[model samples]
Target: MAFTCTIPAVATLQQDDEAIRITRWDFEPGAVTGWHSHGWPYFVVMLVDGTLRIHDGEKATDVPLVQGQAYMRQAGIQHDVMNGSPHPIAFIEIEVKQPAALKQLAA
Candidate 1:
């Protein structure tokens, strides 16, 4: 489904050892992140409960995440994350980073 992104609250949770970076973002129902690409391998931990649909090119996945559940993702992936449920969704996005030089090059 087509959507427009609504600005949401974003906060950096942590960044450690060039191995991982975590951030939290909040979204209301019908909110979308628009098309974007992940720079590093990552994972997401569902914070506030909600349903989300992640679409990537020709494929799509409906993932229902509860508080504390986690999902892993990879770099170079382009996708749109949407909050399809009625309640707002809050989650922590963790990016697994490469070495300094590698990450700088990717950046």
Candidate 2:
């Protein structure tokens, strides 16, 4: 997917160690995170209630989120995310570096 988004979202890296990587993403209304793919599985925790316009390769979809809401996606998800809400939005993204090991620990 091609994104002509001139206003890009801001990503603040909180941590990056052997086991995990953490980042906080903040976006103004109409801001976007240009098309990219994740190298590891990740979880998103919403800090502000808002809607995100997700652009998959083929089409765009709106995902409504509530404050404190959380969701996870696997690696290699190629997509673009835009702040669909009229206000600013922020979310914390925790990317698991060793998903297999984490799963083993849960077993």
Candidate 3:
């Protein structure tokens, strides 16, 4: 298993329709999300923003995360995350519903 940033929610519903789940993730400098997959295609919108260093197992790069910006990711893309800021980092993760069969793929 790999290390991943913790998901924090002080309150609310864990699941619902639209098959979409939104989450607020915060990370400090050197923070990282272990290699993992969403199991579904989804969108990501940066909220309390910062920069992130993304690792795709094969390569790594830095992506600037700014407020009000959104990015779409392929379902089950195994990648790692890292905080590139000295301060805390935060963002909104929107998960979309995907069929179970398609979720099980080799990364």
Candidate 4:
């Protein structure tokens, strides 16, 4: 299924030579990120309290977000995230890129 809502990247807070990228995403009601995969480990910090539906191809899960709450995930996760609330929602995502060998060594 294709997502048609307009989910925009409201801001790019930072990007460094060390391969770190920080971006802020704003989602209006019913907006979605569409299908995407992360190539590096990343973390998300919730800027507004809201609910999101995570669709992983076959199933969908609703996740509640609290303002100031944060979560981390390793690379290779693919999903389409959609705002499940009537109000606007926003969050900051920080991506950390590391050498594959270093990532394997740390595992």
- By TM-score, who's the top model here? 2
The ten-residue window of minimal lDDT in model 1 covers 98-107
Please give, for residues 74-98, the per-residue lDDT of candidate 4 as tens digits: 9999988888888999999988886
Give Cα-based local distance difference scores for all models.
0.74, 0.92, 0.70, 0.81
* Residues 55-99, model 2: lDDT tens digits: 987888999999999999999899999999999999999999986
Assess every candidate by TM-score: 0.73, 0.91, 0.72, 0.80
lDDT of 3 at 97: 80
Off by over 4 Å in 4: 1-13, 99-107
Any runs in candidate 1 off by more than 4 Å, and if so which? 1-19, 99-107
Name every residue pair that clashes in candidate 3. Answer: 3-34, 4-34
Candidate 1 per-residue C-alpha lDDT over 40-95 given as tens digits, one digit per residue, 9 for 90 to 100: 98888888778887777666677887899998876888888888778888888878
| Preferred candidate (TM-score higher): 2 or 4 | 2
Residue pairs clashing, model 1? none
- Against the true structure, what is every candidate's RMSD? 6.0, 1.9, 7.5, 3.9
Evaluate model 2: give its lDDT. Answer: 0.92
